[model samples]
Target: MSGDAPISTPWRPSKKDARYTGPRACVKCHAEESATQHLTAMGRALEPVATSEILRAHPRLTFRSGPYAHEIVRRGDQSLYTVTDGVNTISEPILYTFGQGKAGQTYIFRHDGSFYESRLSFYKDIQGLDVTIGYPREIPPSLEVAAGRRISMDEARNCFSCHGTGAAYGNQLQLDRLVPGVTCEACHGPGAEHVAAMEAKQFKDKRIFNPGKMSADDLSQEFCGSCHRSAEQVISNKLLRGLITVRFQPYRMFTSRAHDPADMRLTCTACHNPHENPSADEAFYDPKCFACHRSFASLKSPAVAKTEEKEGRTDKACPVAQSLCVSCHMPKVEFPGSHFKFTDHRIRIAKAGEQFPN
Candidate 1:
């Protein structure tokens, strides 16, 4: 869909055309993939919820920081937030939710032609509200504005660009016509030409951008890094490097010793399919790791692969356990306020009570 009209014209990617042909256009050709992708975090990353639904799920959503109290209440069709310190108060209607809400959901409101994230966010782990991810737990007493964090225009566009498909048209946010969540066009690029060619029964493939076909390093930087911070992005934003940003898989993966730009198996797609929810079973990832780590020079005893040899010495398996490579290597660490633990993607031997590798 383009604006208010159903796109029926033959697609032409000109300066005046609607380049993005929404996920609905891909349903007929990619029904199974489309159906499954909707369940992934990328698929439902952003959603516009009715105030009634928000109130029904979290009847008394609230959080307290210092002398102030932040509460979200539904009044009729609109959802409004009231922040108070027992003296002054500010109320604003929330317009959008920033996450799929599996881990957490931060509310956003529009005012003065821009968006602002709420002070408090709802985390599923606690099933209550807490300070939003990067914000400080306690607000300064001198600052009176309690409506929440106001996002800059660039920040607003960047947030929506990653969270929702077709939310931008060349850096200009089309917030009113956002497609809510990540969709086919988000990864595959605009589907207008692809759909047009397919519908016309053309035998040749009308090229649509596919990250899967790109080189491992290019894929990491362009596709995955479009949202997840890449090595270059992390390096550039040196001040932002810390435990909190380690959840960024691309940055961590590209920084790892295992990352080989020339090796196709080293990419994120080797272990993850964006269309499906990643399996939590750590053992399932062993095969992927072993593909490069395991020694296969044991024809006499094919069932038992030999240990890897290094510096004229053969290493032995851990006496305590065998499988689940991720158990010790990609240890789970919790972000300060997100209330959920994500596996450290740096892929290293982490020791107890020591600072983790960046």
Candidate 2:
């Protein structure tokens, strides 16, 4: 990691006493970015349960696993999560919804002053409820356990830190002051000082962290990876094995042969624009792939090859098709029980009926 790289720990206080000014303050100069970013998945990562569009739209969702029946229903402005096993029943008002529902949305509710992650989540692929990822498959021993899993204070802090901004301070979570979803300050550091400096027409000492200043490796491994799950984090957590690792893009990407620490072309921003929603159009990524993998016809030209070699762009041409490279190379693998297929970021020539690579 670069010494200049901003600390990877989310919600950690800035070196100075700069406070969070919220995303509205960022709209003054970055109107377009702020507007578009709010529409992205990262922008709506965490939402208050009462105002969740997915829950409001569905109204009611139910799932059956073993002897327990889980259900979530919208009541007036609030949503209620209930679990029952014939006789015993547990119900609570959902406090938070922890996803944008592109694939799924999990509910988090407070039970007896403690936070609990609902056992079942709404999966878009199934258009209904199912067990949340990583939850046990076996039947629960009691109604309380069937209702949801209790989470540690540190885990709750980390969850809110990533899903929302301005939620954690020091060792505590200030839920009352939490900002739902990732805003500009979440990645760029708190904007209060920057906003003040800009309003005062002082360009010098605009106190804010710019992730763009970090090197390619630092940006990939530490900056974006901090939330996306870096290779080091996955390995350290013993999550390097199985198809579940596919959801961790940075870790899978780091394992790819195309992952060159020195090459900016292989970095996350090379293909994705964080301010915008990710597009599924394969054509959109062909240019990024071609930046390194030249066309076979282009490689045959001696002059072009010589210039490329001189410019330190000597990556070999692809023997296969040119466009839609990601369709074949980065195949989507469906994780068991999640009901969603994640695009494996480990770019490679995928073979039919082959086992998933670690």
Q: How close is candidate 1 to the true structure, as a TM-score?
A: 0.86
User: In model 1, what are the clashing residue pairs, if there are any?
Assistant: none
- Model 1 per-residue lDDT at 28: 83
Each prediction's RMSD over C-alphas, in Å, is 5.9, 3.3
lDDT of each: 0.69, 0.81
Lowest lDDT sum, 10 consecutive residues, model 1, at: 1-10
Candidate 1 residue spans exceeding 4 A from truth: 1-16, 51-55, 142-145, 295-321
The digit string of per-residue lDDT tens for model 2 on 86-205 reads: 887888999999986555788899998899988788887777887777878788778898888888787887888778887776667789878899888778877777888989999998
| List of clashing residue pairs for candidate 2 | none
Candidate 2, overall lDDT? Answer: 0.81
